[model samples]
Target chain A: MASKRSNFNRRKSFDAVRAVVNDVRVLVARGLTKSYGDVQALRGADLDVAPGQITALLGRNGAGKTTMISIIAGLLQPDSGSVELGGIDVFSNLDAAAKLTGIAPQETGVYGVLTVRENLEFFANLAGVGRTERASAAAEVADQLGLTELLDRRAGKLSGGEQRRLHTGCALVHRPQLLMLDEPTVGADVATRAQLIESVRSMANEGAAVIYTTHYLNEVEALDADNVIIDAGQVLARGTREELVEEHRLSGLEFTLDAPLDAAEVERLGATNTEGNTYRTTDDRPIGALIADLGSQSEGLLGIESLRPDLETVFLAVTGDRLDEGAS
Target chain B: MDAIRAIVGVQLRIIRRDPWFLVIMFGMPLVIMPLFVDTIGLSLQAEGYGDASGAEQVVPGQVVMFGFMLAGSVGFSVYREHGWNTWDRLRASAAPAPSLLAGFAIPWILIHLLYQVTLLVTGALLVGLRLKGSIIAEFLVLLSYSCCLIAFVLLLTAVFRTINQVNAIVNLGAMVFGGLGGAFVPVDGLPKIAQYLSPFTPSFWAMEGHRAVFLEDGGIADVLPSVGVLLGATVVLAGLAVTRFRVDETKEFFG
Candidate 1:
């Protein structure tokens, strides 16, 4: 416990120094740790997002993404941490930070009984937009999200995708300086996803710092966002996709056999059995050399494939787990 | 202030869209009030209300009884926000707890008063119910009762984890408080035990103030004590509600 306490103090000091150095960042969240009873949700997690940049926060279930977002949005108080939005401490001055920050939580939360326009304007109004500007703000958000035609209709009557769009639209209607969308495309349709991505890109282009959490790595690539991979409540790695891919790239040969190889044969090939009947080796040897080394065991070979280095491969390398396997 | 105003507007709009519950609440008592009039009139006469027509007892009785049930709607609106998954969005707006509670309290108080007034006016038209006292005094009674009941239910909203618990309590409260506090029968007619327990309920003070207007020809000055009890209770209940309310706590709306 003493060692753990020392490490926590070290992280806090490091975050304080980093906060001072990164003056241009729109959001600086540091040393964020939260726990629910005996279960620790976050442990000294630190993140920074600059203006006009999109940070795709990738994490599996129980990875503390929602908790972190909720803390930043001022919904849940963190056990220990500080979030600064546009240089203002979020929890200390939540009302002022609320005007500068907007968040779309993981759930679809649009008011079903209200018209789309009403839902949008209500959120805008709640965020402190002037009465005269709320109407125009709602219209602007609806037009951006392609909900102009359905503005007058009740939110419940719209399609699932439309409701999803409206949910996101409400968050951005206030034009917050820092926008956090927690899995915005979970149940969205193909078109809805595309539209949301486009809108998010535009928002970033207009100089809002965005933290988007998702299990879909392709969305990260599509948004061309900087990647932050969190697991077990810690941000393990964060960088551009290309940067992460290059830094953590894994190259290997994987082959499946009709039957499991004996321990002797596995050692001979210097390969590890990744799963049933599938063996992998991260050696730089050519496939020809590995196949020749297989010798008589080659007769049992079913297939051979080369692993390509990409975000998925990098994610697997960093977290030792598949992204799709953890996604709901 | 803006957050509170927006929440009030949204809450009122939501109610306007789904108004059948309030309509039924209004209609049910109107039906029951006439049924109990003749029976309760005899009791009021025996109690020495010289010109009592029973409308004097039954009309405000129904209002106070059903008014307890109607006040529960404020708590329901709060839980409904959870059902719709919009509670977090509202919390994320950074509105203080007092602002959120006030937003809900304001509209329900207005609706509660309107509901009671409409019933009293209908009684005046249907059963020749006349106010022997100042109309303004009666309005104060209605206003104080509305404030007190809404505050009480909001405290329940803060303390309860599910809408079902609140519903059960509110339903039981309407009946128990109404029976004990002379909403269904005059305090003089209730058994000795209930009459002793009657003053503990907000309905008792409300009924006391209403009896001053409808039965005793009393002025605002005469009903101030009853109003004081309700307004004082409102302050205590509302303060408790604010303290107990937790924006981060998840409340279940539907079973």
Candidate 2:
């Protein structure tokens, strides 16, 4: 157990050092403005995605996350702006940029007539994967995405989760430099979601820049990605989880005791008995000071956790609304 | 080029999975060939064929006419990608519009040629149609006609927004162009107006080449001019298709 913990520390330290070492911007999009008739999709949006990092583009439905990533992927050209992938202009040199990017849109798409393996290889070949290495690459991707068993099955015949996984797998088969996945876990089952998250983490760990968009705050937390909260076609703010949480200025001490406490004891502790077993400090103060004040009473604490702000709270604080709401 | 080749394989696989359209295209022409064989053969006889069976006129005519409609399958395949929500994924590949168009057109051209050839063979077996001229000339006509029709529908696919619109236009165009080009009867039998308009349709050039082979015992030289016109038409239509196709435009399958 000690060895495993140390190994994890080493890996964590390596990630931190690597994050700083490889600071090149994989995607540089600036002043992206797109107007669809009366509805303005994006208005002067700018995004910079660093290599070896997962940047979660958080928003409700109408926040233009899709529009931004679509332009970066070369699926749509911004009406007026510039986007570069790996330093190549995405619009001026689309095919070159396309060679370096992979995107899984909100919708699931695959060739129904082709087998799962065929679908993977087809996209891989399109993205410049050589014919000699495509088969093994497909196998490797299938294994990574939990699709090895269904490789021979027709894509149309797969279950919903399997198909969704394959849809995402096709996008990354060529192992693009930048991967943009738009809510890849929306319809995914528990196992599929976990498998996808693992795949995405592995990709990011290997130094691919990823822009993952989702309305689910939990996905962003699970990814531990840098958060860019966007709304109404603009980026409100961007930071790491701790930075955003701290930036929101949340501070409180919430805990539970092993034994039930009377009102007299709760008042002495100066904590609110929000529920029968839960206790929360009314004032947002440093938990360390509260713990020091408890002194000998600290031994009685069964479980102690700070009321730090989560991603949802940060999103609400930035966007003035929750993340579950659909596009207005 | 690789993107085009890859799409060609995928599109061919998709078409193979849905063979019902091919069956209908194949069946419709076979049924029509026998119904008009006698009357059209008598019509060809009046136009100075010695002992002509209507099989020659009706079989080649139905082949050219229905082959045009079969070309719609290419448009439908392209639109189906949109319906499947795969259009953006394909566009995201950054394949130029012309490559994507070629991918759909090349496979349908091959299939269109096959559709016409299969009908000709079936007509021979079922209606006693016999070859009279150079088989190479007849093959050239089949090749040129397939190329011309495929290019024509590809242009329409690029310009139109929905599969329904393309279908309505292609189905109507097949019948009207076929009639105007003398697929139903000889150009000599049509009114002066249709004969005047006949030369404007690819069907006219196709039927002319087929008749030269079946009626006049023509060699390659006799059919070369018709092939040239068909190829020229193919190039012009392909140019329009390339100009009109937009990679970013969202096409609707049923819209």
Candidate 3:
């Protein structure tokens, strides 16, 4: 037990050092602008993704996340600016960049008529995996994504969650240096969502640069990574989780009442009214006093909900818009 | 080479998965050619055309008819690729443009070969007709002719947005040439102006080249002008296809 504990500590330390050592940018886009006639999809958007880390692209719908991923994947070209993968221009040198990048698009790009294994094999070959290595690579990806049993099933016949898993597996089969996944865990159950997040974390641990875009604040919370929040085709802010919430000047805390508290009670606690039976108190000093007073008023509080500063509050504070709005 | 193989493998899988494409590729020649050939035979019989072998003309006529069907079917396949958004995916892959073009061309060439062989067998079984030229020489002529037609289809796919427009355009061109270029009736009986215009049609050279081997007393050397025209057409159309091909997902053409 002691040896195992030491091993775990060693592994954790290695991950910490490796994370910082691999912080060099793997993909960089500057002033990227794309227009479809009059509607500008990207308005000088810029992003830098580092190696061996997950960067969550938090945005509302039509915020140009898909457009950014397309340009980085070499599927679309920007009218101005440039995207580079590992110091190579993606659009100008597609073949070279293709070796490093794999994209799991939002629309599920798998061929429905093919089996799950076949889809993985085909995409692996397209990504330059040799024939001899395809089967073993596919098996490894399937196992990592918990899709080993569904390998022979046709992709079209799978459930939405299963299809999403297969799509991620297909992208991972080549073990690409950069993986761009747009809404990777949308419509997934809790178990499947955990599996997807774990798979992504493992990939990052293997030294891949992963860019994940999702509207689900829970997904962003579940992931341990840097954050880039986009709004109106531009970067609103970017940093670590704590840094972003702090920079945005947003605070989060929760209180449980001995009984259903009235608006007067909530005001006495120095918390602002948010909704029915809910109040938000951002002042640290007032929260401490309220907690002390609550203990004195009642020793039998039925429940206490802990709230931590998270991406959702940071998003609302910075963009001045609700996170759920404009999510398609 | 890997890129080429991957593109071709994906395209072949898509083609095989669609039953309608298989029917058009293999069934159209078997079912449609005989109707046109019978109509030609009825016209010849009414005119007291030839000896006991007056039906022999129907055999060569069916071969040329097969050419027209092959051209239209292959051309429409290219248009369908555009409509289905498969072309956009192919372009985004690591596959080179040359490999993609070769992938599309190779399958159509195979379909053309299958149609030619089926036509020959069906003609012999139904009408007691046999090809007059060397089999190897005729195969070369047919392969060359199909390559030229595939190039034309590639050009149409590059320029046209709607499958309906491409179908209408290819069918209209096919009918004009099939009528005037001697696929149905002899061009000799048409007006002098029509006969003069026939040389410009791709089917005109294709039919003349096939007839030179299967109908007239002509060697491989004798069909040089027709071969030259087909090769020239292939080069120009391929050049246009390469120059005009653009894969942009944001274009209005997607709608």
Local accuracy by lDDT, each model: 0.91, 0.86, 0.73
lDDT of 2 at A162: 95
TM-score against native, each model: 0.93, 0.87, 0.81
The TM-score between candidate 3 and the true structure equals 0.81
TM-score of chain A as modeled in candidate 2: 0.77
Among all windows of ten consecutive residues in candidate 3 chain B, which has the lowest summed lDDT?
B246-255
For model 2, the superposed segments whose C-alpha errors exceed 4 Å read A1-22, A250-308, A325-328
Query: What tens-digit string does per-residue lDDT give for candidate 2 at A1-328?
Result: 9965775576577568657744678888889998888999898988888887899998888789999998889887788999978889988898899999999999999988799999999999888889999999899999999999999999999999999999999999999999999989887789998999999999999989999998777778899898898889888888778667656644466777766777887798888775567677747667788778666677787877775578876776677555783432
Pull out the clashing pairs in model 3. none
Docking class of 1: medium
lDDT by residue (B3-95, candidate 3, tens digit) is 677766866676677657556545554565555556665665665543224334555555565565566565555555555434544555656
Query: Worst lDDT window (10 residues) for model 1 chain A?
Result: A13-22
What's the C-alpha lDDT at position B31 in model 3? 61
Report the CA-based lDDT of candidate 2 relative to the real structure.
0.86
- Candidate 1 vs candidate 2: the TM-score winner is 1
**How far does residue B21 in candidate 2 sit from its true spot (Å)?**
1.9
Candidate 1 C-alpha error for residue B118, in Å: 0.8
Q: Looking at model 1 chain B, which ten-residue stretch has the lowest summed lDDT?
A: B121-130
